[model samples]
Target: MSVLKPKIMMLIGCLMTSSAMATEVEPYNKANAQQLKQSIYERTATATSAIERYQLAKSEAWLSYADHEYSEGGFTSAGKEAYIQANQLLEPSNVNLVTQIISPSQVMRRDLWWQIEYLKQRGALDVEPQALANAEVMLVWAAAEYCELGWRHAREHFISAERELQKVIYALPEEKPFLNWSETETPELSALNGKGCHGVNPDLWPLKPKTPVEPEVIDADVANVVVENVVHFAVDRAVLNTEGKRVLEQIANILAEYPDMNITLKGYTDIRASVAYNIALSQRRIDSVRDYLLEKGVNSSRITAEAKGKLEPQDDQKIEMAHAKSRRVVVYFNDAETNSITVQPQWRDLQIER
Candidate 1:
């Protein structure tokens, strides 16, 4: 019995050594590449519906990265893993993935799952299909890039994903006041702290309401899209701060959504600066805002930005506050179709806040 036990142990050791682990070298070649490329091509070819196409795009992006890896670095294992994940998008019907796409191996994808799930909760997929679709596809691509071969070549995709998601967050149609984002003020752009998808703060994502959004009230104040005291400059400076950029980003999103609603940016400065300085300063200010809007894809024709110099106050009470308020840009929106605004004459003409 002892002799038999030793022989059995020896046989077990031989089996374990033979199947120790996957070979470091890959079985990748031009033939294998063509085979995989063709396989992924077939799995996602018949996508016609919005959801199907959405998933299909993600699969295609993953396949592209996989092909790059195989051709550039001879990485078969990671590429093969990515291919498997990509195919998951097309198979088993993407209707099941409306809330969240399943990624089994790349844990980084899990970091971004909360965002996609929240958007589904808000029901924003249908509201901004192209934007959200682009976001989702880039998100999976980021996950694959970040994880595959420990390569950090996914920063571009991560940034692209964040920008698209930003559009969906602020651009979705809503009857309510946009979780206080639209009615109250523009929230600061989120930062990445090596956590969620691209390190964006999930808590910063707007709190979606229980009821669905109302498209009729997309820009409830369509005639006055920029109704708030949005861009208030500091002392005599015209350069936009972080807060100003945030405000403009939201306005840009609005303008992009409603191209028919023309925007007016009126730049103002404090009483301390000379009239000439204030004029140039205010010009710089509005120019800054205008250039920002243009960079954000707002048509130049849709904007009417001018420097209004300073608005002399009537009293000295809280003079500092008044000066701060004076150094501001008043944003007003008018319907291009009617060439008019619903706001009263005084408000439409920029009532100088005392």
Candidate 2:
């Protein structure tokens, strides 16, 4: 009977209504392929983020496969390859790579649902709001894919999509109530804003504050300095966390002290997802590190960033420790004196297990 209870109930009602509306869409038709492809390509071309680009690529590949299946009667070998390529950009497992054809339409829908769920589990909802929007779009696309397969597939997809959408909607932050409100907010309603409500936990949103680290000094007289302080990142995150920022702060101070020294940040990732995704993720991480250095007053000309992705994992074993070690960015430093004195760069020929 509390005032906030009514507000919470109203919000839930509205979300349920939206979910219902989402399920009432018409059946997908083959003739929409060209239009869908064009739309997807346009989005890809203008996408500012890696996730957005990958989402568009997935949509393009799905539509292309659908077009081939409906118009040409079943998937052509070439078309299947294209599908695999597109799938590889987001996740690069060998099992997904070696598949000869696209997954069953319903299975694909389920896979999309799981991928979105994975993102939500990993705290992407708070860190990357666009991912939530992309997930919703993907669900709608999955529903359409099911529509093409027939009534039963469509029904299953619709139900799945509705469930997923409801979760996302409930996860979104609620608006603050007016200060002058006559009624008191219940403890449950207040807790929703802080710790989340209706199965959503705001504390788990992955946006933790980063602690600062003291900067390290690099010896200018050294022939080559490779700081073993590798910056680690969470899965699919380009933004630096507190620990990462601290490491970069140290690197920035080193760069500031040795104005003539140049640094390269080589980014690498664990073998969890696709090569393309890892590569892109690595680049973003390095870029973030480099940008932090620049912000800390390092010359842009003295810094460079490179991405090796999953091709150069620190540990190739399929273990948590291996994956943790692999998701890192290493700093390599060289001064004019050091570069001239050394016959060969230390890490140039270093072999890393993929």
Best by lDDT: 1
TM-score of 2: 0.32
Clashing pairs in 2: 91-274, 92-273, 92-274, 210-242
TM-score of each: 0.39, 0.32
Report the alpha-carbon TM-score of model 1 versus the true structure.
Answer: 0.39
Cα error of candidate 2 at position 101, Å? 56
Q: Model 1: per-residue lDDT, tens digit, 1-354?
A: 001133322321231110132233234456655665676467547645545545555556656656766777666555665555444544543233332222322234333434554454454544444566667656656665665534457787777776566545534333222232331232333332233333233333322223334334355545443323347666656677665677677778777677677878888887775788888888888888889889999998988877878764323233544565577776777676334333311111111222
* Overall lDDT per candidate, in order of appearance: 0.53, 0.48
Give the residue spans of candidate 2 off by over 4 A: 1-228, 316-318, 336-354
* Clashes found in each candidate (C-alpha, N, C closer than 3 A): 0, 4
What range of 10 consecutive residues in model 1 has the weakest lDDT sum? Answer: 344-353
lDDT of 2 at 142: 48
